[model samples]
Target chain A: MILEYKFEYLSNNNTLVNFLTNIADASDMKFEITKEKNEINFYVDADEEAMSSFASTIASDLPMSVFLQNTAVSLVQEMPPSNIQADKTKQFNLPFCPKCLQKAESAESSDYYNPFTTCPMCCDTKDIKEFIVSFGDEIKRTDAYKEVFEDLASRIHQGLGVRFKTLSGTFIFEKLENLQEDKNQKDIKLLCTNLANISNVVVAKKAEIVALACIEKPQMDFRINELYKSKNIIQAKRLSVRYPNDLILYLLSKELRALGIDFLSYKNEGSYDINVDFENFDAKESLKIPKLKILEQNRALVLESENYDKKFMQVFESLKEKNKAHFMVLLYENSLLQKRILNFYTSSRDDDNVSYYAKDLEGFLDVLNYRLPKSIQEVFEDIQKEESGERLLKNYKNKYPDSIKTALEFDLSVLKNASIVSFWKIAESILGFKNSILDNASLSLLEKGPRIDYKLFESARIYNKEFNYIKLIQSGMSFRLAGVDERTISLGYIESYAHFISNIADEVNKEMELEGISLSGDIFADERISHYVHKSIGKNFKIFYNKDFVIQTRF
Target chain B: MNILILGIGNILFQDEGIGAHFVHYMDEKYEYISQKNSVTIVDGGTLAQRLIPLIVRYDYLIVVDCIEAYDSEPGDVYFFDFENAPDEINWQGSAHEVEMLQTLNMIRMNGDLPPSRVLGVIPKRIDDDTAFELSEEIIAAADTMEQTVIKHLESLDVSLRERNPQITISAMAQISFKREIVNDSGI
Candidate 1:
């Protein structure tokens, strides 16, 4: 008796169909796949014993994809004729499958020790490898790639940095413990081989783990576990982690696993002991979250859209052409919006595009039409000339006595030109730290830290048709003056900023029916800020993000 | 006068790529636009500020791109001078459009902005899905836009000579979008 099994999956891509087809091809099983509007169905015919074996293999070795939402297998009475056509799904950047990995390791196999060994189940790396090999002697080409792989593994084992190409771009990798003395380690990400080891270092849910290992291979920030925190594996409370998403990293992981190394730290830029060069394969960064992408480098949660607008094209076109009051929320470089009005084009002036960060205190004060005392004006000018934050504070206190107290009493006008520089400078001065340390203060307090009450800071005040960011910054400064811990103050500032962004979005959405709200810039990569904005305004309107590009500013 | 015929758009988006494809359509079909004027055509693919230096070098600029307009249907084309752009035409529709406007403004501030005219079409589709192929509406509109740009260039004292066995816009799109050279003339 023939038994039929059906599998259902979600995702617009053909990754599942490709994987199933590969599995069927290897097992000599006949299967048929059909894609409906929402879900894809796979029908397979086999005997009871064969069916059980196939299901077990699939369960043990199914490739993780951010797109694979659900899979269910049920017995069917009738078997349909094979309608399997040539697999035309876009090739995904996936790690080697068990079968491909075995082929790479076996000396008898033609692909033995080949760094670029990959099957159709993963990516089209074989074609890439072939294209590179076509340039030179095939044997020498294989030997060179082998040498590079061996050198990479040796360097990784020696606790030295190795530079290698990923599908997206070239990266530098070193063991996390070895990079303690490395001063330029800010953008580094801890790489793990599997979810089991990843869970040992960071606190991650099952879904988050799946997202990290999925095809997209986005760097996800997670709270470092107690053991890692105590060990100080990374100085920060939260660590960004990723699993291997390409062939080179996949092979590297195998070597790392054998060496008993759980994690390796990698950054986009760094000098390394060894450099592995291969034919450039320009790979696009895949989607982290299917619909709503937050923090391009971090965790992505694939959520299904129930009310997805089919006429999004029509809406986008209409917004682009005729909508005068529509605001483009560009917070990436710095929070600024381009309000397309009649004056924007007719007048070729720079001030038409207002910057979120106040260029200078005097200019900002001038814009608000607030007349500063002659002494206070000179004091600000002196502070601006002071290069260091320490000196700036010292000179301010000496020149304008009780300035912090005075600042507390001042009613700020707009959040648009709020001094993000001033907020950071004040935090740095009080904490006796530099800009780098203070820059990460908010993110360090993301997962676990003391929370300050909202009442402590002045609520978001609307004045002169803008949100008051200066008042919020002043409140944080006052708290710092009151001897609040840096962690608590940082948490407070982050929460306040999140609410500020949400409030701005809400206010804008209320004014007119917008085509859609766009969120750009690397600043949105902050989980706290992105999450708050999404949760607050995501329900009301469609928030568009960079589809082809990562949210992080590349510069 | 030195003339620069620039087409700007992201080819990854279906109809959003009409401008980039149109320039290639022009380049492939026309060998020399005029002997009197040195005319160069460039496919400025999603580049905004980066094209400013190249644009300023030319005395006259003709930009082929997509624009959003009030009460406009897909395939509708609008031709207007940069100084006197219609209020109905919104250049703030896409990121590239916004950047292009800023680039022009920056040039104007630097006192280097050329006399520029835009030949824009109402695109039918600009979605997350990547495609090199144009929508049926945009494919039909390409001819009208091509005529408009050519007419504007000719009025600028720039003549045109069509290449023998001229390549169609659809064929050019296939070559550009797929990165494949089609041997079959029928494509």
Candidate 2:
């Protein structure tokens, strides 16, 4: 008797289907496999022993993909006519499977210690070679791939920065302890080998861990634990952490693990002690199904688009040209929320026209002007002239001796020329807090804190046309002056800003009848900001973010 | 009538900045009649909604920017009324285009939008690295754009007088490029 089993696999991508087909071909059982829509049907000459063995093998080793929504297996009555054909499924560029990893470590195998080694069950080696060739000349093949990685690991262990090309791009890696104190560490990322390694460094939730281990391994910012914080390896309270995505990094991570080093700090572009020059391969861009996309970064909560906009498709079909339209909003930490506009005819996707509008703080002040007392103006000018917060506070303390009292009584026009940075600088001084990096100051408030609502910043008009950033900053300052904790003040500011931005977006969408909103920029990566923004927006309009690139693309 | 000529584009990209370059070109070469009708030229840059207060105050608006049209060749110039935009014309290619259109639509919804027309050209080189030079095709097309704008202004009872010698777009590009290089070097 012949028996059939059908398995329903969700996802449009061919990764799971390819994996199943490859695994079936490797099995000794005489089985026919066919797919109809999302279901994969298998027919076997019912040898119970062979069928049970094959089923157990599949159950033990199924490839993990975020796109695989659900799977179900059930016995079927009938099988379609056998139509065996050549396997033409596109090979996914994914991490090595358990079998491939075993082969890579075995000395008897041809793929032993080969960084470029891949099988039908894994990624396409030919595509990898082609991408590497695109970087430069032909690759110099060698049997000493493992030796090279070991040497690189040794150098990194010796506290030297080494540059090497990953599947994504070139990066420089160094021990966190070796990083210079004065060096800018804003863009630095902590790369670990696995979940256990990452957990040792930072405090991460289960969702965050799952996100890091996912196929599209994104760099996530997490608060450093007490142990790492006391070590003072990095200055920031929160560190961007990520797991190794490429083979070379994976191998290097193993070698580093042997040396008792679990993680390293890295940045995309920098001067390094050693350059590991080799043919660089590129990873095929993965299909990103955002779990929790806040602005541009994808986190743990899966946010999937339900369906294509029918109205947009209708407009697209009516149009005669193959031109692209971009609706982008860029939100940087210290800079103004910049809205870039460009609609142009292009021969190809590469022909992207770029432009920028340059406006100084004076330009912003001209649009949102406010009046202040003469005394406050003098104090603001003096504080602005001081180079550091310490100096600013010292000068003001010597001059007035009761500057905080004055700050509490009346609104100051100091914010006229203030960006986010200057706002933090002035606020820190008045609140008796030491100067901290903007990211650290913000992250410090991630902990649960008291909720305090201060008076809204006094604006000239209630519904101002432009974003009243100055007033928002002033509101935070008021809370701080009113003896609220720093954490509470930070939470308050984030909430206020989120509400303000969401309201503006809602108003614009209502007025323009736009299909959706597009949010970009790195500042949106902050946990509180992302949470509040999404909560405030609340399904009123579809939110679009970058799928190909992270919110903050390095280099 | 209060007439406003707003030039928008990013100068960093090669031909993407043709609209901005054209405004500078117009400013240098001609002086328009402003007695009867107040005419203002603004290098709007990549700004969209931020210019709402300034844009709506005018009685008539002329926008100069890069545009994409179906079945159009590089350097193809297009002129159309904003209210009655052609089906073949698309302003969804880049961020600023969508934003500028959205800004106009928002204003229209509030009944504050003025009678507006867009004078745009198909750019030849926008993907190239930072450069101020316009492509030869776009440079030639600018003449057609200039003449059209002049004719429209004339219809509004405004005339242009040649106040200075004709300054080539290339010369304007050279000046802008030099200024950028200096600023970058922090000299």
Candidate 3:
């Protein structure tokens, strides 16, 4: 038997003939194929049994039944109905379009498809029973990704998204349970890829968003490649590749490299997308650091897709334990919600970790440049302000004056015979010149023994639990007094000492705002005054010179 | 030639102190070089500014330090002549109060810098640490660094004679070398 068939598509004919030849060779049959412009003819010389089997295989494998109407006269006269009719009638009992009563078209191929399957004239599918029935009871069975995947395709067509591939396709998707789970993925991936002429790219962070291809035309990929090459970016072509998910990651890696941040993917089984070690990071590479979660020893960042619906706060909560000392960086998402969440966390936890919902890649970079140093500087300033020990000593000095009066008097009596030069000198010497000798070390309570000489301040108020007289004397010594130590002890010095003691009483009263401890009313105040009394010969009355008399009465 | 081998670095920071380590190595291993030749080996420590006059007084100044390799691998040794290196290459980061390149440039501006060449190695670890230890990679490259300096000195027509090899290295060899006289008249 001899069989001949003509094919208008040379590619289809070549593929069909090649397949048939392999089959015929196994069956010990001979075949010839001849080609012309957009035409190819196949001739098969075979026995009846071989010819029958060959026709059966072609009928099943080639989808040739669709064109049976056109091939009826030239080839087989007794042709089966077009497979389009067979396929439609077997799948759905009702007509696809109730208005036009439209059936599956014979000439339609996968190349010819409609995202909107309803006839354009009707502009409504209310009358389509099969269309409505398919979605009626089984609407919940529709895969959630169908709409989003379609949106991604549209975004590519509108020049708003880049198409690339990753290890898990372009997206990181949770497995959805559905009747058509496998078929739906194939359809969506195919449709989105064909629509954009590039595989859809999965974007999780602001950096990846910046890496999105904004090219206006199909040829623009090459232009981007050229541009990247001129800029000495070695991964430009990989980043510009139309298909595959690694391109966006590759582009982001380059941008991070410029910022001295090494961008890496999850090496272990983990929820986060990227991890960066800040130890090797060059601070001078850029001014800001983006939203970063500093771990105990390392740092990481997680970027969610713009369509993410999971509770991001919950993820951050877990991250806090791992990064107690670090900041949490949320990508540009709901800004108001991010602020509310960050405010709550900071207030409740007493951690100033920031949640930066960057408006764009540039904004994210800016925060990183500014926040790192600012945070470090703030820590240093806090340390500087902790001079609590010094403040405590000053409080003691202001609260108790009578406690040191006796000691001050004793020191003066010893100095009375040395010399008489300046009154300020005697006053300073009576104050024990503690400010000149003690260092910052001497002021610290950690050192054993009294910081100041106990001979200078004799009252227990100086050594009381709330007041350490030693620290007071040491702190007093910390003050600067120039040329006072050089002057000899004189009446002028004694006068200054009395004046200094009275001034201390006035200053302490003003500072402490004591309710009842008046110089005249307090028991210790009278004793302190009487200690300074000295006999004097006077015409009218016996004149006693005390600290108050030396200071108030200028004789 | 009157030669000064200045080693600069922070001795407290592990690998960043490689320059000081190289000086100790040179002082002990090649003591004859300094004793025989007019070579002065100074432990510059982290103070590059204090060595400005020493840079001007020497006929030939050789600096040994650790370098930030930038794009290159760690332990990679590089030699740069002050008068003939690329401008960008001189911007290598330093662990000192002032970077080595900036110090050299200052002396250059003064118009009295001796012919200077920096022999440096990219350290494998410049991390935070207090130990004076070196990374294995840098320790392995130390001999090559010594040879590189020797070859540069040879090119400058300076010769070194061996000392009595029987004499053991001493603790005093670790000390920084300074001229006894500060007056320029002695030079």
Candidate 4:
């Protein structure tokens, strides 16, 4: 078997190069494989069933619940209306990587100025010229759009923030007309130079890449293997130890069940779901039977936060008046707590309505503008300088002797793994900005700051530190959103992770022009929403921030 | 007809550092080559991550590596498309999740990826058990890279108005990982 992408199955933007680039930059899916155009290929032990499932995912065109970065984008089948698509010349040569052209999500990301040109996206002189020429042709060809695009292109060429995207994975310029007071834009270079300042970078992609490479590949034994003695090999090596996928499913399912919620394990999709009745699944189809059962409802859906409880009661109560019992708000109250779980749910005053429950930090993160750290943040200087050894750990016995034993038990190897280091460092950084610090970087952590991070909770905005067993067992939709390798998470390297979700706001911004969407008012009323799904996992349609409650239910 | 320079080798195994060494060699010895922006020097390495950032955007990709050409003598010079390259010619190994071959496979799978050619120089020894110095044969191979580069430039009809006569034409093969003895104080 071989691992490869069938081109017809992938969106134009989801090219192999782009996918690999994203994985290299942002994810940790091991067992990399490749294929020529026509055949299904596998390397590093890809199974026939898994391969077929992947192929079907591409062919079926099912909506996926992909949690990328930290944002939750409800991808639907809608592309923003196009205004000036035939005029392609103006849009020809805009740079590809936002990390370089635009500011990184935070100042800690990395320095980009004078970077080596061999960087795949760093076009050579000719490529740049080719880009500009493409831009020019699009402009010259478009009799009407030319005037609009040219100004934007010029701004971009002169180094400014006029870059935007189209539904077809192309960039459109948004020219900032009338450069307030300075028509000549004298400080263009000076202003542009800030984007490249190394000193300004607090976290960098390059460092992360280097860190990823440091972990030694897991050891494997291959004695007297005819495969190794082969003349030539096209397949990648299989891991000696395969993590138990079934065991994980069982664990997660059992955990959720223990929480008075039964969950369904979709073996092929690599995701788990709650025991919601199947007859009420989605707008397209209703489930006739729920895979699992929930206890009786209308028992006072005890919510952790009063504000969340209030929001759900209001939205559903308003809809409840209309007799819209399609589904109740999706949360259930649980009395027994192994861990403090915050939940908010809206049910029909009667017992027949459906309810949604989002049971982790992600579900509860957006209440009252709960702030999160930028994708990458600088750790405190002290933590980086800590002497995390048995010797140093023992010296702290007087203050807290318990620390010595725990420190000794800590796995230095796991800690040394660069990716893990960066992960914990990121977590530490996020913890620092929990409305805690007053630095410029910390200020960016404000809910309305440039970056946004979402949490994926079990029911609502509660964190499950002790119920780690169940969360670990049921690798759900929000698993990838945590920006960790499935293997690592499975091995229990991390109980929580955050995906660097690309904000759907940009997609919204582009839809207006590309798809010709003209919503005058009532932002949600006329918006032609699009659905985006991950290629493999068919998880629930999870929206990170809505009424600030973490509730998962049939929509 | 872009001029491509590929530096290839396993940086971890001491002597396999030749590929990176050649790249640093060019970066140091031939400063003018890059200013032209006509030649792209890539550190192909054991894994292809370094080369990835520019893979999709280039027209030509030239890789320099220490080829364990089993059939050939030590320090032999050869170029072969990896897909059709001879077997018993171990261009890849199992020390990595992402190998040079897999990376190349990815590039091949990615339509519109750049055309590539690997220049594999014969290795005297890609390990440290041998002499602790650059082998004379490897040094000679490293010197030959200059000629190959010039041949490319000549083929492209790119005349270097200020060519450095002192640099020889050879691609060297050495092993070096990231942790080198080089100090930041520039001592």
**For candidate 1 chain B, which ten residues in a row score worst on lDDT?**
B178-187
Error of 4 at B165 (Å): 9.2
Each model's lDDT comes to 0.56, 0.57, 0.35, 0.30
**RMSD for each model, in Å, please?**
27.0, 25.0, 34.9, 29.3
TM-score of chain A of each: 0.56, 0.57, 0.17, 0.18
Error of 3 at A31 (Å): 99
Per-residue lDDT of model 1, residues A147-240, tens digit only: 5555556668887787766664678888877865445555446788756788778877677776766655656667778887788656676676
lDDT of 2 at A450: 21
Model 4: per-residue Cα lDDT over A438-523, one tens digit each: 11221121111111122223343212211111122122111222232233222221211111111112122232211111101011
Q: Rank the candidates by TM-score, best first.
A: 2, 1, 4, 3
What TM-score would every model get versus the actual structure? Answer: 0.46, 0.46, 0.25, 0.28
Better of 3 and 4 by DockQ: 3
Interface root mean square deviation for model 3, in Å?
20.8
Q: Pick the candidate with the highest TM-score.
A: 2
* Candidate 2 - chain A - TM: 0.57
Kindly list the per-residue Cα lDDT of model 2 for residues A191-277, writing each as its tens digit: 876577676788887667766665545566677887887887766766767777666787888888888887888877777876654
Evaluate every candidate with DockQ and list the scores. Answer: 0.01, 0.01, 0.02, 0.01
Error of 1 at A238 (Å): 7.6
Candidate with more favorable, higher lDDT: 1 or 3? 1
Poorest stretch of ten by lDDT in candidate 4 chain A: A518-527
Residue-level lDDT of model 3, residues A458-478, one tens digit each, is 232311112112322322222
